[model samples]
Target: MTIAPSRSPAPSGATWQRADWASSFRNVGTELADVAVTASRGTIPAELCGSLYRNGPGRLERGGQWVHHPFDGDGMITALRFEGGEARLSNRFVRTEGWQAEESAGRFVYRGVFGTQKPGGALANAFDLRLKNIANTHVVRLGDQLLALWEAAEPHALDPHSLETRGLSRLDGVLKPGEAFSAHPRFDPGHRGAPRMVTFGVKSGPRSTIRLMEFATADDPAAGVQAGQLLAERHDTMAGFAFLHDFAITPNWAVFLQNAMAFNPLPYVLGQKGAAQCLASKPGEIGRFFLVPRPGSAAAERHAKPLEVPAPEGFVFHHLNAFEDEATGELVLDSIFYADFPSIGPGDDFRSVDFEAIPEGQLKRCRIDLERAATDPAGAVSSDWLEQRCCEFATVHPARQGREARFAWMAVTEQERGNAPLQAIEKLDLSSGERRVWCAGARSFVSEPVMVPRAGTGSEAASGPEDDGWLLCVVWNGARCASDLVILNAHDLSEQAVLELPLAIPHGLHGSWVAA
Candidate 1:
């Protein structure tokens, strides 16, 4: 796609002044209410069907007070549904206790995990450990239910058709009240044709405890799932402190990159800081990997302990994909790795964060030699940095979720080396050493791109590569002070269409595309 330069005047900020990126932090209070999406560039592809559901912080302030961190903002869900040759867009906020109470009283009522403090000083916040589930991290559809997810707590169910909050979901009694469910659920297109959702929750301490689960969604006549039903469960105990946000899964294995870190709750107990602020990385230790077997796998029958592997001393927040090579007894895992946990002290302002000083995530390919796993799991782990271009929010063709594939796409920075806002979408050809970038330049920041398989049409239908699809994502256009849903050809990284919106959406983290 052709790169575009900024047309609007730059906005000012206190610290590093990147005008385009600075606008991504602005508030998007009004909902779209099912508005028709108009394309300004090219025609919408006929093969592209179904809605692109995305979630992130929308409202950043309560009354006149600003939130200390963008992650603390209220969850806003956006759906851009594509049909025949047109698009329909709608957005809504997931109503939660904190959102309702703060809106009703016209002020901040809850302390957020990141740094949004209460009205008074630390004195008023002291010893009050109550947490309000923000439900702002991700959105997914399984079985017959639509859910807005947050990593630390249960998901809030929403009406998929109307974007209305229904209530909290318990996975058909699989999860009890106050149970923790990971927001980052990995969809396993298993070999048996039984697609399952895999996720886990952690309780970190001296000896951390992990609860892993696999659940199947009930299929309805409409071809949509009704709700997720429990299929399997396992409890594991690991040594040392554990902080897990995401994991990767093959047909019979689930792998997690656990950062070596320590948690101190004293400052949080004294109301001086949020619980997240207390986490400190163990500088001298190597990062670890926890590999657990699937319920029906041979390892499970033996009641085997989780295979532990030591990795390069660093941190990993997200993984692109993974697959098992049963013939070779190797597991190929590709993920984004950082040198350390990127953080700031309680006194620092998140809005003025120095991007250059923070560690940028680079793609890394890790190979686990399962043959040597039992005797020396740590020594068996080997990794190599794929590319130096800073990137994150990586994805691949839906059908290639847990298999060896040619390409992986993700949001990348405009520059080649340093850390900056993600302003482009990169297509990394793993088989070949070629790369393609579709950049909107310094004026537009993007979200995670969701790939949809091209429907069978004419000649391309019978047997096209899995990577044959269109890439869809939302872009915050700083030039227009608005947002656009951009579409690109996955094969060539060419712009197909740009559906412009009247308002801007705060840059979001993750999203999914459901086939029609």
Candidate 2:
């Protein structure tokens, strides 16, 4: 699910802007059939031969009734393919059982996790335990499967080239019926050959159960993955119920930070609030982290004996990257953290959220000392602010996934300070204190940066020089009510190209770059 800030009690600042932003809030129901995009600005890089795939909520409403929250919307697959100095675009909705049923009925027939209730309210929603398999969170290519994933349910497979739904995938039976697979999986860059994917799923209850998985494929010399295969699997149980979205993985460890948010199903059971809306962060509680040894590693025994540490996990939704410092032996994990749980109220609408009341995520770097954590919890770790500006969805070069990299990219608010809509992209230097930003005009909305290394620069020496390629991101053009794929030179954050589309794609959550 998307961790968007809840609606603030106060209204947006007085001098209200025009409602033209409603265009972006509208659903882009159009499914363009591989439309060739002509560059509106600079030329497309000739060496850029790959497809940039993005996933997020597309169809936000049914039968003229808006969803209680954007997370209730249906997942849309957007593909931007580049080859021989040209780009082609195609989009389609993930036709899951829930999406198809709602489309056929022309109204909401299921209760949403956030707050959308049945039209008949209490009577229509009470005693209903069915959850919609809305595969709107993320998209990933595992082996030959291009899966549209939702953390709570099995992934829906789709055709990579045509964005066609191919039914729910079972990962070759790796996942049983109704089994969950997390959407946010970490890529182990330090793996010998091909990068190993590390992901986890949770079954929360009195004795919460967590399963960790590892997958890999043969490293293609050309950087194109042929197929993925599962390598390892491990399951362990925790003490209490927990909420988890993303995790950080090192060479030998996978770290999960469990938030202190409590879920009271009383309201949900009584058909008053949705499941997600009933979660509230407990006061005066410092969350903890569960560090398990990664599967297929020398320290595999440590998987059953996870190291525990007190952390300000508060409500961390995403981990940018993590790795162990060779000299210090300290595990450094950088994450996007918020001050409190991003709560969803029953009547809240994210689009109408008050900027003043929302707490923005700041980039934080935490240093973990296992030996110290074993003796005293307080001295086990130390955290320092890396960048204070409100930021989220920070990404780095793919080669630097499990290592300390010099550069990081993120979507940030346009203003110099305070929280607002994301209208700019920032490049932060991890080693030095320098920062660079590329602002997408005042009215444009930019998504996460997908860094694609230039062709022929696949060698370690070439990628070591950070920013040797291009950054691809989607920017919503408010004036034209369309979207543009803006390509920026990673080195200096200069605009390289802009490919505009005829229709606007709703702001999305996560995206990936798969080489052709």
- Screening candidate 2 with a backbone cut-off below 3 angstroms (N, C-alpha, C), the clashing residue pairs are 143-228
Return the TM-score for each candidate structure: 0.94, 0.93
Writing each residue's lDDT as its tens digit, candidate 2 over 1-516 gives 111221111234422233434567777768986899988988999889999999988988888788888888889999999999998999999999988998899999999898888788888888887889889898887777788989988899999888999999888888988888898987775455567777888888767778998877444646554456677888887776778889988777888888877888888888888888888887898778888877766557544577778896557998889888888878888988888876557766677777768778889999998767667867788999888888888998887887778889888875656777777788888887688878777557788888888776663425446788988999887767888899988888888888888767888888998888
lDDT of 1 by residue, 1-516 (tens): 333322222344312237767777878868877888879988899768898899999988877788877888889899988899899988999987778888899888888787778889899888889887888899999766678998878888988879999888887777777677888988876533567788888777899888999877545446544448777889888898888989988877789888988888898888888888888888788778888887887667654788888877788999999988768779989999888898776788766788889999999999999768878876798888876799999997766677776789989886778798887888888877578888765577888888887876212232787568899989988778889888888887778898888778887777888777
Give the whole-model CA lDDT for all candidates, comma-separated.
0.81, 0.81
Worst 10 residues of 2 by lDDT: 1-10
Off by over 4 Å in 2: 1-22, 219-226, 301-304, 459-464
Q: Which ten residues in a row have the lowest lDDT in candidate 1?
A: 6-15
- Model 2, TM vs. native: 0.93
Tell me the lDDT of model 1 at 491: 82
